[model samples]
Target: MRKVLKADSLFFYFFISLLWMEVIFRVSVMKQSYSFGILISCIFVLSLAFLFFFLCSFFKRKAGFFLSIFLLGLSSFIYASQFIYFKFFRTYYSLYSVSNGGQIVEFWRDIAAFAGKHSILLFLFFAPVLFLIVFGKKMLVFKSCSTVNKLSLACCALFAHGTGIAAVYAGGKAPNSAYDLYFKNSYPQLSVERLGLLTTMRLDLQRLITGWSPDIELAAPRDSKYIPTPAPSDKAKEDPNERETSGKIVEYNTMDIDFTQLAANEKNHQLKEMHQYFEQVQPTAKNEYTGKYKGYNLILITAEGFSPYAIHKGVTPTLYKLVNSGFQFTNFYNPIWGVSTSDGEYVACTGLIPKNGVWSFKQSGKNYLPFVMGNQLQKLDYKTMAFHDHSYTYYGRNISHPNMGYIYKALGNGLDVKKTWPESDLEMMEKTIPEFIHNLPFHTYYMTVSGHMQYSFTGNYIAHKNKNLVQDLPYSEQAKAYIATQVELDRALKYLLDQLEEAGVADKTLIALSPDHYPYGLDMKTINELAGHTVEKNFELFKSTFILYTKGMKPTTVTKPISSLDIIPTISNLLGLEYDSRLLMGQDAFSNASPLVIFLNKSFITDKGKYNAVTNTFITNNGKTAADEYIKRMSAIVEGKFHYSAKILETDYYRKIFSGNQ
Candidate 1:
């Protein structure tokens, strides 16, 4: 065997491993990444290898080689696990998500199942490690050089890191530098596309150690007069799906905001930009639909793992009735974000994007969340409460829900439900309804658990309980198992409806329900089967049901490109609550201010078209692509929403605005 550490030999093994990792990263993540992105990823991997090689080279060659093998093997495992995770969950993990890493431990069995399914891909991915271990150990060589050579190596590492950042930064475009590209994009799936997985993880680790904020100048829209307010009605050119203008003037729900004065006195430049931005936000005009359910008792649910597939007339009559007989949102979606359930729940409840890496809801317990249904309704003297069917402390809901102005309770606390793999949603309804059903003007929020995954009867209590319900369907076992879980959710809804009717509050209560996310744990084959065919993975897979109804109400259909993020603002608008439209990342779907559904990856669905940020592709609904300028403009707005949403959370922008938290 050759001496183990020739300078080139060390670099050679390091790079071979690094390059293979990149290929796996690309194949697994950045499959659609542009040629430029692939090139940038290559440079990033090389830089990382150089830095690690130099740092570890200070030790004996034997130690260095061993360390190199260990790290390379570890890298292979990381890439493989991440590949499995992304394959199943359809999202990537970030450093921020690691804080909530406890959640993943609960799904170890599911993770293992997924890993086993993708074993072949993983085997190929790690094949290079075997080569490095066998051929590398025998053929590789290294020798300690003079101080001059050591210093030169040190400089080489520095140059590599520096050059890599600069080159990728240039490619990242403004607002998203290489640092932002790698660390703060909030969309890890996209980050892995541009930066190799190792580079992205390295950046993520840096961010975890030293919290990062996007490096962008505060900007005001070029034309401040372009407020998102409705234009004068033109009946001759009405959209086919739009409610015909009654030849009446539209008015806005005017908040007593003095942005001009606020901006003038604002000393902080960031706050000033926010004030300016809000100043120009076009207030969605109050329409006939506004306050349609004002003063009504409200029961808002963030149903876990819900999808349109959950609604079947024969199997889930309650859901089917509500979906067909209420404000059925045809184009609604619940985009899966970084923290899908927690973040999804946060978005629905707080109308804010869960800041990347932190539980925004749990963190909100420390802030003044003024617009949550529990908080907003409590102001109207409604007895507000929130509940979950899991452990009271799971995801720190005990802290977050109460902060949302609810008298919060869950499995371990006030609510008494049997301890099972997943608790019963119906039992929760049975126990909690009496406490609030008779309390007139009450508002209750539920973060439901019945529809949660591990889509098998054996692993999921709700699925097992309702397995026979979906067994007759000509669907795959996994598909049936997934639907069985939702049947329990359906039964839960049935219990809720019966309680409301018995209490004579069925018509008086406004019920709003949407999923925390689609059933991601289920196989895609099952997903396609449920969808009736293969669906567009990006937009359609995220498409879901948002149920808004009051008993005996006329069914109204909305076709706007709306999302879960828009739920709070939409409900607030419907309930006649005053909020600044500009400050919110999501616009009211009922507003004339253009519907935009933002996704985790910064892609968007608007009324006119869809923009896939990963592929950098714009596909118009009309089949003809829109102007490049239009796409760029839409992309900017999407990017702005992401940047400011995170900023809003980090800075407690709401508290600062209302309560002087600055």
Candidate 2:
């Protein structure tokens, strides 16, 4: 028994340590209900650790000892770092973020605070290393393994890996299943939960290097359109064909581009397939709201970490007025994307789902984005400009915004705002409004920065600046700090409205605003305090307010479910812009088309029901029944949206179709 222990001690330590880290990570960072995939992840982790063991066995006594220690330390650091990162950001750190992440240095203060708060868990991760250093020499044999032994270890590694793969296949190939994540798709958070972090990172690096993209296939067509039946007490109607009852022929928000002809002329199979797919998509019908704000000056703002909880009448009265007044969308959402702010901005401006693992906005810098409001309105002789309150080059907005047809400015280039940890949104509005407000028939985009993370008075500049105002709030310090930062945003909006009114364009201008994401920096407990109840994680966590306000506009409320993804198309239709609604992943909210709000994990909410992908269950609205067939069809549609959205980024599908005309 002693001899056997000496011979295999190193391997056992590696395997046990790796398994321990995986379990710890699963419990803490990946705090989701797992399935058989959890077992598969364990086996896969075992196989990887075994491979490390086998490779380490090739070294001599001294080298082997230090190598094992190095491997163990690396494993500990990866798990520990991911734990703190997820806790801090409410998302996993992707390899892409790491590669492009010089700005991460700015978050060192927050990271240090996180480390201090979670020191126990952080110490537990490194305990294995301490054990190896203390007792490794007495128990672990560092002698080089014989060729025969090496061969056996290698065989065991391969066999275990093969078994894990087999188990994954046995789990099934349904959408978001273990098999789909492993072989076809890449949803980073879900992938980490199911496949283990190391395997997910390996796949991410492989895809990144090899230019691999998710394989997209067309879903089977539905037998009939899903017309949701609203319950008796339901105020909102859900008829799929319900629209304005004017005695006029229905015209769709479509362009003159012949997709069928484009597909026939295209040689690339993927581009052809995309053209064919979009050609068959049903275009949204024009309604009474269409052209309601035609030829209006536009100011689109992607507010930082804004939510309905920030809509207090006393604190953020401007926000309250705008939200409650013009084009009130009671059931709106601002779904958190993988890349958070950049992805949210991409979705709102481009009407596309962000491609996972990479900065889609940066990627789109190189692609043709004819659909974004900036580009769409630019062609009509509108003076288009965009501003950000932070660094111009942050998230590569310098590249992406210009490609969107905006004369872009941020901290480094032009638009000088006071340099703080997070620059002031109010200052940005004050300075940039003058740049474009006087330019008649203009469209400007503002990416606000006041409501950024590290939500505390000490670390957050904006929060500290407005701390006195939130001092009397009956909530935790973090919650108050978050609200205080949003107060800055409220003031910024007030300034914008005043300026517009002064310029005699407030009535002629349309101001549309939505958040980049929810205040993920605040914990659920703090969020609950602000919300006055437990916020439902699946759907309600994302329920936010979308403000489409113009001076003297009617306070009409629409109860259809919508998301930031629908912002571009909704505004495009309302402003009477010529855009093919079929090409966008989201439909015009004012149109008769059924509302579908897709979350990051492929969970979706439609007028019919809310489908939670994690639980594989659907909850119908107002106790209305949804047939299994209906759920399956909606799931397929969601899957297609994800798949094709990625494909558009990969192939630059829009540029392929309209490159000649432009």
Candidate 3:
């Protein structure tokens, strides 16, 4: 025992422990593809362990042993906690998210249940610490090292770190590559997969401290050699209002702001570049459906965990009717973002992608969002109100929503919905409808909560409330519970429609509702069970229904791909709001502008096909080959959207551009 357990063995123990935790995290949680990133991660992780090893070596024998144990325990706990969070939300929480995660306690019951279920994996993560606590003293030396020895250890640490840095740079600067993720991008998942969680979080802290922002450069369109086979148009049917035009010219949904003038007169280089970029962007032409709902009241809702699976004629009749009745989008995707719900709302409401690492909506409270429905309609003398059935200040919506020109309300504020584990959306509608139903031409927004996760009958309050209704459904318990929660949403919509009809504004009120994200709370197995087929994880997992309906409208089907990002511009166009189309990242769904649906991981679906960023493959819609140039151009456009969106949050670009106008 004495011969094998040498003082030099301390480094081995530390290295093994750190590597063990990192490998467990990647395999159990991330399940990332085997790539050069794994090699880079190992180098970085080795460097980290060496630094810890040296620090632990400086303490006295007993003190160093205890310190080693504590460090290992703490590391294990951190990894385990991250795993639990990812399991619950299907997205890793950033340092910013953790700092603002006071509301995490609200899901304690669900979290506890998750821990119980994944306890085996948790034990695997903590196995290193347990091993250390049991045999660390016997297997390793913890005595303080000599001065010369300590100096040698310190040098080793530095050399290892330097080597790691060299390995990272050697990986090259391609998009989503190890080098790009480490230096330029803020993609949390990919960063963790490529650089390891420790390095990713370290860099996150560094960026947070230094106010580092990704550099954005203007992209020139790449010329394509391959020609596309033009298929039948996927545009929605011509509006009845346009059939009456009798050859009269159609107007486009655009404002008078000249981007050329804006760029020429701009002082800041960043804003000037933005203006020049927008100047070259072709604005969407006004279609027959443009301004079809002019002067109509708008009610936009971002339903919690809503999906196509939530829509069943028998289980959720109202949802079924609303989905199948008007403006049916066959390829609408509600892509999951970094900060799931808040990010989803930000994309749909603001027509901009959410910047990773920080809450973009909260940051936008101080910025000018002239294109959001709340601000756009409020300026036109429409009464605007926003509601949430959760904490008023959760995700800082209290600050963000009101800034969007809404009389925002939630549990802590004016709204009076009974507090529950997951509050009732129906009760929210019941309590708040009277406040604004009488206010004609109102633009109301809702962030519902009844459809929140922990899809178990015992854990979810909303699920229990409607348990009897879903009892007969032939599905897994989780799936049934998920549907039960959505049943509450169905009832809420029904109540809303009834009230609108009673107020004699059912036809005049245009209700546009979409999910904040897909039903991520449920496991993929359960989702597949409910879907009755194996849903493709990459692009199809995000496929959801967008509800755009009034009392009676022609049922128009749009086959072109769209996304939650397009909601703002689509609504803006339909309401005849004066806005610069080029300024928004999303095009109007009904516009002649080519349909482009962007996902969080830089994946995109265009009228031509879907491009999976992770696999670097494009699947054409009509089996015709897409030009490599087309793919490159689209990738550049996606990258630009992400880069400039982040810049908008950091620099308040919207306010800068519209300063004189505002």
Candidate 4:
């Protein structure tokens, strides 16, 4: 009995240590500090140990060995399955639901890429730990067993199996609170169905080996597109033909849609009115500025969390110069997107609005993505490349970038940059510019991260040498800290411009600057305080600065409400690239399409007025009565945009568009 106790204790200690090591690895890589409630993890570790001990005591030696092998194999399989599911299939599953057929292939491809990239590290990290857990103590101890001992071991194994199965089933129904917290906070987009399946699968083997399952509901796939219709209690009794052909029917009570309750023909009339508004708003191309800087290098920088507020006379001279001396957009606005930062980038680069509730960039990986500047320039025999100073895999940029027809490079995977929480944008510029300038007629897209949010001193500190310049700004410590973060970003931009000038590509390279999103994490009070007034929370609050600069071109300011969505079409027009009008949801800001900025909450802004769909209020630059006709018109445009965005995601819209079939 004492020998058994000692062996179990050793096993528990080893397993707990391994778990802790994994925790430490996660913390170090994320650079996030531990706060309170670490003791809960300790308790969990102890609980696992207790269960391990009970199993070892009940099972015979040979039976226990087989049980351990089974557990290890099962866990490995589940982990591998998750990687495969996420990579090849864009859809994730819970224990309760399955992904669609299209998503299944996507999951497979993602796994292949991940495996190809990290197989060696995976084997190195897991193999030694697995070997130690299974075989470490075997070489040190040997014992012979009798019939009684063998029978006892078999009973223990059976008990372990029963407990594991129970645990998995229980866990599927109701996961541990701690696990739920971690899952929700870290991976918000993970479907409940996938979570349930994983919980069940993970616990089943553990419970069979240990003795229990966490009774939890297996998560099922959430049908975001499902619109429920009101039906009789006994829906099965109704004739199928009675249901509307345009609408899909679902079983769950939550899926019920009250289509009959929709406001009558007035809504349709309003939609048509909005479509008319778009037609009335004409944006003519400037024929006077028709000189084409053909075959010139073009550099587009989408700075992270960049805001118009960042532009100041003394603080950001270069930025101010670009804003004042170039073709600056005064009323330019960037509507906050549903997925926000990276998603906004997806819209700007693809010239398509992102669908709500999913990462468009990740979804775009499956279809052909057209890049007006990169792909079109490449066709013109231009060297095209895209650079990002962060993990390319975070938003699945690895897949999306390549699909954009650019030779993509990012930190850790393809490019070398300074190692920091958010890698230095300056370092990225220093390393990448040489590769880009060697040849003429190149187009490079850069996604910068130095201006990311969580605007406190610690969060925004830059590792560059020019950090001292921001100390004299007349602002609060927090505000100064926020500005300091952008200091590096500003410096990075200045450096790139200088390099272009030195290489004599400044005149040849057309530079465009736009923000991915407003710095939302910063205190609104601080922002308002800095601006010397209350910043409107509607569309204007979300407005961003846009700069289009060429060395000697006459600066022309346009007070148009253009969005990131217009970037591709606008650039295409500027570069004289021919594209089918039907290919993009956004029109050229300089073209005949009415310019509109869309917000995360489904509101929109245009030159005429700002419409808040939630409040049903229309506010114009000059205080005027609500224009019912204008409101209806804008609503239809927004609705059409939503419909198209969804269609693009569900169907292969880009493929059809690029192939000239749509």
Candidate 5:
């Protein structure tokens, strides 16, 4: 035992300390659910630590020790960073973000805020690196091994790693695909719980460097897009020539898709498969609410960090009016996708899940994003325009907005709003109104930034600008600061309403507003303070406001599970515009189609229940749960949506399906 201890005692001890600290941080601080699966993942992390140490063993003793300490420091930083980032942003970064180092620099204030609150945990994360550097070479003993023996041991480490991975595969119930392995099943928090920080970083680096990606095979929809035929057994199905059924008349809107014709004409096997798939998707039924706002102008806003908590009538009357009077969605969500606001905006704008890691909006710059609200309205000669108060090129919106059929503008572009550190939403509305307000039958999209992060009065200009309004609120400083920033948004909406009223389009213009995400800038404690209770982190944290109002349209309340991903198709349906429902990932909330909300981690919420994919557990709202086969079937469908959404971004599938769209 002594001999073996000396063999790799320093690395072994260091690794054990790092692993346990990470485990405690995750289980205790991050408040991740404790499970035996995470224990299995810790073992896998230990194997990785051993393999890394073995790989470095080939170097001279002192050199290897120093290098190992360096590796330790790097791993410490990554883990600590992940913890801090989650604390501040409630999202994890990919290795691709390492390439965007400047973006991280921009969040130094956020990092400082996290460190101020959680110093002890952060300190412990780096203690191993410090201890190893101080004593690893001089005080720690290492057993001597010949170069040949080191080589043999390294090979053994490789064999052990392979075996551990195979063990995870055979016993761990991990998702089958390599992509699903790291992404779908093991999200960052869960991945670290299961695969350790070192291993997670290793796979991330491997993925980023090798230009390798998960080859997700998109499942085709089972039924063709054509009208479903009655079963032969159901009254000896009359001639297949009868395409319409009297019992139910499904409305396809005006999306003139001849699936039969497209299938016959398409030469590409991939395109034909896509056509076949969409043909089977259930088209959203046109209810009495359909075309309720036909030919109405649109003012769509994706507000930064806005939430239901920010919608106080006293502080934000315009927002309050919109929420109470418009098409109110009682259970709308704005899930934080992996890429933050860009992806959040992507879901609302494109009605699709953003592909993980890559900026899906940027990739869609070349694709036919006809389902985009602007694009759909543009076909009718509505002057479509998009505005962002921040950098226009942020997230490649410069390319993407135009692809969505909008004449896009941002801070540096044609639209000029006073530039503050975070910019001002009120100024954005004031400046942008003139451009499109007079253009009757216009559809405008605005990505507001006044409600952006580092929610404090001192550092945040917008928050400070309205600090006096929130100072009296009985809330934490952080919570007050958040509301202060949103005060700017409130004023902006007020300004927008006045301008529309003056422009004679208040009632004729449909205003739809939603937060890009929850206020991740506010800590969970602050969120609870605001909510006056403990908000369930998994699902309730995502609860948000989706405002749709056209001056004084009849107030209709929609109580259904819906999300930002449902925005595009819903708007298209309300405006009676042409859209292929089968091609969209989300259904219109007002339509009879079942509501399904998907999270970045693949967890989901349906009307019946919630499924946290990380735990592989489902909890039905009622005691009567869905059948295993039903859940299994829904899971497959959800997986297919994710897979195909990614495929659409990568292969530009829409351009192929709708050749005339672009």
Candidate 6:
């Protein structure tokens, strides 16, 4: 009996150790919250209790011990494979292109740093639990299982694992279809076969991963001015037989309009009035620095999950500097992109509206992306590079980054760091800035991860030690915790600015700071607590900050409403890049676009005031009522713009517009 108990203890110890190994593997890959560990532990404990009770009722001790060992080993192996697949190979099969070496290195460094910070606690929590399982009497009863029962249990475990593996493989290979299948099976109430049919037609993940290799045909380059014959004006009044014969006999060709033509069209009366309004509100461009440094380098940082709460008067001085001294956009709005966090990056960088229910960056991998600051500046002989301190391939950014014309780098791909979960923003700045700064005429984009959500002490680094600082903020505990995470983001920004100054390129470098999106997953109560009251459920609540700081530029403010899509044309004009103004859907708010034609669902704002398309109501802040005629005209204009933007993306119209191949 004593010997049997000792053997059982050993088996339990092995089982718990295997479980800890699985947990560590998952944490390294997913960066899941510590709460996941607690949940896993609960599930594991229950499984063990079930096993022990079943074995003790009928089996002998020795047999149970062998059976438990086999189950433990098998489960551990299966869990480990999930981590490996998710961490390394998952992105290769995604629609987005995979990142190269430098990018992966940058991501890995953050993961290492995160692991170092939590390793001690993880070990302490897991070690004793492992020991108790191995030596505890409950484990000894499992050793008594009969051979037949043990084999049956092992087969059941193997079958369950195979099913899980198959499901994961199928889901990864055909995400949309698998998603539809899951919804149909698990949520019949929400599942629609028609919706699935629509989605499945366009969602070809396999084709996206492999890319198109269609046969190429070279043709004479065409210009936008080459217009096709217009349809007869009297077609509506013509006989049906005449129309049918005409349609059958000859195909009608539509004229393709180029960006230049589109811009020219927008130069009409209404747009001219809108452009005038923008010029009146445009801030003065300041060149406070007299000397011309080699050439200006631009650094655009889109911090993930960042919010205005990160900005404090004293706590974050550099941010305060940018907000106060640079060309600060007080009413700049970043509308939530369809995919939320990363999709917002796509919109801001590419100045393209994301497609409904699909990731624009991923889908647009095959489309021509013009006006990307990185791609645009590259034409000026600038060495353009992009950095992300997380997995380089998330959201298919590895592919999209190259398409944006950046030589990309992430934690695991190239840049080395000390931690995981989130690589230190400061470390990314420290390692990558030197490579580009010395080479003058360089533009670098950084996507930061330190401020990501899951605002709890164990899940986030900010809440680990800095809770005391925000404890007195007039917000809920969760809100305060969210704010605390930004401390690291704040510190990283200050460090990057200091490095630029130290490198003597501060004046020549333009730093554009923008949040990827509003931090939305926070509870409404928490958001309301932070806002000091309930926030309006409309578009304004989703608005974010945009700051463009060029060292030694005179501080000015623009209060006119603007979205991130405007950044491209705005910055291009500011930098004096000769991009055709018409090609971009977003006009330089400093150019011909209205102060308000911002599109969300439908166009919400017109020059006259805010218009709710659904309710067909217009409200002016100045208390001036708009005439019925003006509302009708404005709605028509908004609808026209939406139709044009969609056509531009769907038909690949920009290539002809900008390339003079209309």
The top-ranked prediction according to lDDT is 2
Collision pairs in model 2: none
Comparing 4 and 5 on lDDT, the stronger one: 5
Query: What residue runs in model 3 are displaced by over 4 Å at the alpha carbon?
Result: 1-5, 146-148, 221-251, 265-267
Kindly indicate the candidate among 2 and 5 with the higher TM-score: 2
> CA lDDT of each candidate?
0.77, 0.85, 0.84, 0.58, 0.76, 0.55
Clashes of each: 12, 0, 0, 50, 4, 46
Which TM-score value belongs to model 3?
Answer: 0.93
Regions more than 4 Å wrong, model 4: 1-291, 463-467, 660-662
Worst 10 residues of 5 by lDDT: 232-241
> Which candidate achieves the best TM-score against the true structure?
2
The TM-score between candidate 4 and the true structure equals 0.58
For candidate 5, write residues 557-630 as lDDT tens digits: 88998999888888888888767677788888887666788887677887678987766778999978667665
Q: What is the lDDT of candidate 6?
A: 0.55
TM-score of each: 0.90, 0.95, 0.93, 0.58, 0.90, 0.58
Model 4 scores a C-alpha lDDT of 0.58
- Residue-pair clash count for candidate 4: 50
Please write out the lDDT profile of model 1 over residues 609-644, one tens digit for every residue: 888875678888899967776776666666666777
Clashing pairs for predicted structure model 5, backbone only: 41-194, 221-277, 224-279, 225-279
Candidate 2 RMSD to the correct structure: 4.2
581-600 per-residue lDDT for model 4 (tens digits): 34466666665335677765
At residue 309, what lDDT does model 6 achieve?
Answer: 66
Q: Candidate 6, residues 1-662: lDDT per residue as tens digits?
A: 88855644543454455546545643554333333223333333334434443444354556545554555544443343333323332211122322222233334544465446656644543454444446644644443456675666555445543543344344432212233323311111111121221122223333344442111112111211111111222331132112334455321111222223344556454333322222112121212221222257888888877777667776656677788898778777776643566567877787666543345676566667667888778888999999988776777787788888889988668877665454567677778877787777789998887777656655566566567777777777777777777777777778778878887988888888788877764766677776666886555676667888878888877777778877776766667664544445455655333565454445365445787653457788789887776565555444434444544455555464446531
